[model samples]
Target: MSNLPTINTDTIWAILQDKISDEVVNQLVWSCLGYIYDETKQAWDISKVVDDWGEKYPEPPDFIANRPPTVKLTRSIPQENKQLLKEKLGFKGYKLGEFGPRETRRATAANWLLSYLETH
Candidate 1:
């Protein structure tokens, strides 16, 4: 047998018994507990799944109406760097101010400038 301790059916029963009563089908209760045990080796998996996801993708710095806000440039790009960025954008057929790609947002523009500075 696997070294993992056997998930107790009785423990699953004890917790489930209160949530379900005589009116509910007995098979449904057992099936629910069995499915939970098979998936998580425990009587419930919601909290475990939440904890796992939290570790994988943590919360952002802040939220607005329960949603993360759009990213922005963190600091002002210097005049010289800005001029260089405009030249770089001009080479790529992007004007940045008077006429630029509609798809370019503040974060993307800042990233492009930083990437250019890094390479050159």
Candidate 2:
């Protein structure tokens, strides 16, 4: 029982227009929600699971709450899909100097896309 915000999968489905699979979307959203997959065990790694926050604790922890929502596209999604998302979402400034390093640009674009989808 964590206090992290839940993503609306319906919104993702609508935005992706069936270009990406539902399973991959689930994996991306779950990763963003702090669940990591353990390949050797072939299951979720829950050792680092956060404790249930009581009703009084209404928000996620600072580390999660402070940052913009982002998916680790490098690890969870294919590079081709990442590029497709950038193109579809009209993300600019993806070059090295245009928006920091490669990873930063990708992450920024991902965050931007997420925010866009969630809002509209």
Give the top-scoring candidate (TM-score): 2
- The number of clashing residue pairs in each candidate reads 0, 0
Off by over 4 Å in 1: 1-75, 92-102, 106-112, 115-120
lDDT scores in order: 0.30, 0.41
What is the Å distance of residue 60 in model 1 from its true position?
5.9
Residues 35-67, candidate 1: write the lDDT tens digits. 123345533333333213334323221211112
- In model 2, pairs of residues that clash are none
TM-score of each: 0.23, 0.31
Q: What is the lDDT of residue 19 in candidate 1?
A: 34
Once superposed on the true structure, which residue ranges of model 2 sit more than 4 Å away at CA?
1-14, 49-113, 116-120
